[model samples]
Target: MTASTLMIQGTSSGAGKTTLVTALCRILSDEGYKVAPFKSQNMSSYSYVGEKFEISRAQAIQAIAARTEITPMINPILLKPLGNYNSHVFVKGISYGKMHAQDYYKKFALYKGLTESKNSLDHLLQTNDIVILEGAGSPAEINLQQYDIANMKMAEYCKAPVILVTDIDKGGSFASIVGTLTLLEKRHQKFIKGFVINKFRGDVTILYPSYSVLKKKTGKPVFGTIPLIDFDIPDEDSLHSNPKQISWSTKYLNVLDKEINHLSKIVEKNLDMKKIRGLLH
Candidate 1:
């Protein structure tokens, strides 16, 4: 099957992009599509080792959801921030050495990192039926757009339709969506086919009015609002002790496992699966 790509970019970090990608992967996989989760560049300390290289824990969860094997190519560029404004750069799962912020931006982006990322993406597209690309941070960061390989730039490179996600629980959900659209160039904005408001609690009826205005303002459909789930999943970045450390061997994890399974059903029902299928085309 030919791979169609959809890139999930959030209004901000921790806006449920990872979870949505996981759910979308599972939904697509369950529907009989061979899917893979991709992130061109990821900055995370909590990671896992694969057969060939290391990848973020979030990517591993997404691969599980998609029922696909994990590969270093799924996350070609990894920047693990090591305190004191330095990060360890990994290109295609191998260490490229530690670098200061300025040096990394100047030396790597133009020289080799971007090329490696594009190659990895091309490989995934060739192999998968659908590629669910999860963008790092907000794509609307105009200052970083020129150097960005993980957000809109990656979406543009892959020719993927994008779904902008924002956290309603953080408040200013409307502002986040509109602000992101307003900040983006028209071409980049055009890539955003839909919007997703995540972590919304209470009746959705109250958001009807706002949703209407948002659609009118951005000329994009609100895909669906995802309610907050209490279960702990592997977060990309959090101050709390790593969820990756918790072994599934514990009795408590057995109950958590069932809840996580139930979560996929919730995701399938709440999201507009039909629309999602249409968008991929």
Candidate 2:
């Protein structure tokens, strides 16, 4: 069988998608799976060492999680979009020079070559049991949605299952998760196996109500609510640096539980609480 892929995405930017993907890479690796990580396109200033070509720092982090060396093929297209519609594209981690948005669109055929390159690399790395794919920013941005070579489009290309991840700290995370589920085309939504609520604070008991509501609203399983981890992971987005700023507090747990219970009364439920408990453990 071919390696399975899980695409981690979020409702908006700075939703901790990258960090969670990296963590999952680490978790799966610990389980003795030969894992690899891939991102169709990444926009970051950080760089990583590669045997034949350079790789994105984000992929490098995942590589570290997998205890493997960085490979350029893991991140095929690296777009550094400065102001304007122009961005620098990297093919196989080597600078392919720059192109304006219009120029790039005009030459969209070139992306197929990059995609093929990634497929060839995946074939060569047949030792991997799983390949975790990371999606770009919110897949809901309609303006850029069609031109999207990442996220859902990338999943379609690679034929991978998707795991939509949203940040609960963002207040409207429920809406964002539901909106993303509803807005995606049928094909894309079919590939989505479950949803994860990230950056959760307070007690899990308190969060269960909202989780149940979201599950009922979207008809998707709540894979887990990743509590705010204090690891010093680098921030890929231009957001707050300290994750510790929004962790569970003893005083707030009771109120949070009450709120969740109240919400649960109004919405339906369909989450595997046992699986969620396993994730926490």
Candidate 3:
């Protein structure tokens, strides 16, 4: 049986996309589904597995979610740009070495062979369950939109349904979600099964009206508004990398407060204070 895949994309980066995908992978695996995570092309300096295996640290975290060993096939064709249009390409976790964007595009067909190889690797791993694919930044980049093997095109390739995620904490989340849906090609919209509003704070009741409007506008189901969680997962995006250095804006401070309060209640009931205090310090 072919493996069913789902692409979790965001309005933009740092929209809690990686966290949601990891949580879903864990939840599904707990429900007895054999799952794997895939990313078409990842461009991050904070990588795991080094120059040997070109996958992102985020994909490695997904491997952990699946309770499986990390493999390069899960994230093939990683590009680490070192200024200019030049970048170092890693194929299956090993450095295939560096090339400029124009040069790479000119020889782009060669990467298709790599993608096919990765697909073959995925086929070997599929034991009749699911594979969750995470997409790169906004699928709206008009310039790079055509060469989007990371988000929409990857979903089309794998025949996976897409679940677009937008961060409400970003203020224009409703517009971002609706606009993304509207901007997608008619064919791509068909694969967009649902949309999610993430990192919501305060009463979810208050957000229902906004959510309703978005649903009506896009004609897509709102999966659920995911409350912001305080759990410390590794940062995959630079935006959230330096938590200590970056003070939360007033808006996000409220989001953090709500998340902290929620977690405190849970910890008060289930966790030992002394043990938790040690980790906190």
Candidate 4:
């Protein structure tokens, strides 16, 4: 049976996309669904080497949350930026050499990137009951829009319903959400199921009055608000220069499991998982 898909996209980079996907993976996995995490392309320095190759450490952690083995199939493209607009690339865990940013996006992204990601995503969809996709960054980047194989393009590929999230702690959550929606192509905008406000620290009900206003302005409801949580999970954004990698030692694995469970509980309580699950259908 073909699997249903739900994607988590953010208004901007570093807006809690990775953590949210991790939370959702555990949430669904706990309910007995065969869940898997997919990200079309990831630019990270930290990765977990599998049997043959390695993938982003964030995806590796997410696989554990789903109770599955971390495989390169989940993250088809891995880029390690080597400075001066150059990045070392890996495809399906094998090194594909390096390319400058200009050539990489202009040529490789169009010719090879799409095909590899499509095949990998197809495999996950066909074998799993559900696939939780995480976007690389905001889909509204006008400069990268044409060559964007990561955000809306990937979301469209799997026909995944998108939940756009923004960090409220950034102080422009409202405008960021509205601006992102405005920038997306009308067709892509229609693919969005709703929005989620992330990193909220203050009273949640204080933000209630604007919920309807947001719905009226953008024609999408605020699915939920995730409070600012001090979670100690391995972070892809912070792991760039991090010397500490995830240890598969049983002792470390147990701690990681507890962190995942803690995060999933908070997300399940605040985020409208019931409504988000409806998007899969």
Q: Give model 3 RMSD, 1 decimal.
A: 9.4
Checking candidate 4 for backbone clashes, the offending pairs are: none
Q: Which is the better candidate, 2 or 3, if ranked by TM-score?
A: 3
**Residue pairs that clash (backbone atoms under 3 angstroms), model 1:** none
TM-score of each: 0.93, 0.79, 0.80, 0.97
Cα RMSD (Å) between model 1 and the true structure?
A: 2.2
Report the C-alpha lDDT of model 4 over 3-121, residue by residue, as the tens digit: 99999999988789999999999999999999999998999878888888978888989999999868888999999879898989999988999999999899998779989999999
For model 2, give the RMSD to the true fold.
9.3
Model 3 agreement with the true structure over 39-79: per-residue lDDT tens digits: 86888776776444547777876776676667877787778
Off by over 4 Å in 2: 113-121, 238-281
Could you give candidate 1's per-residue lDDT for residues 142-190 as a string of tens digits? Answer: 8887787888878888789999989999899899899988999888988
Candidate 1 local Cα displacement, residue 48, angstroms: 0.6
Q: What does the lDDT read for residue 143 in candidate 2?
A: 75
Q: Candidate 3: lDDT of 280?
A: 14
| Candidate models: Cα lDDT each | 0.83, 0.67, 0.69, 0.90
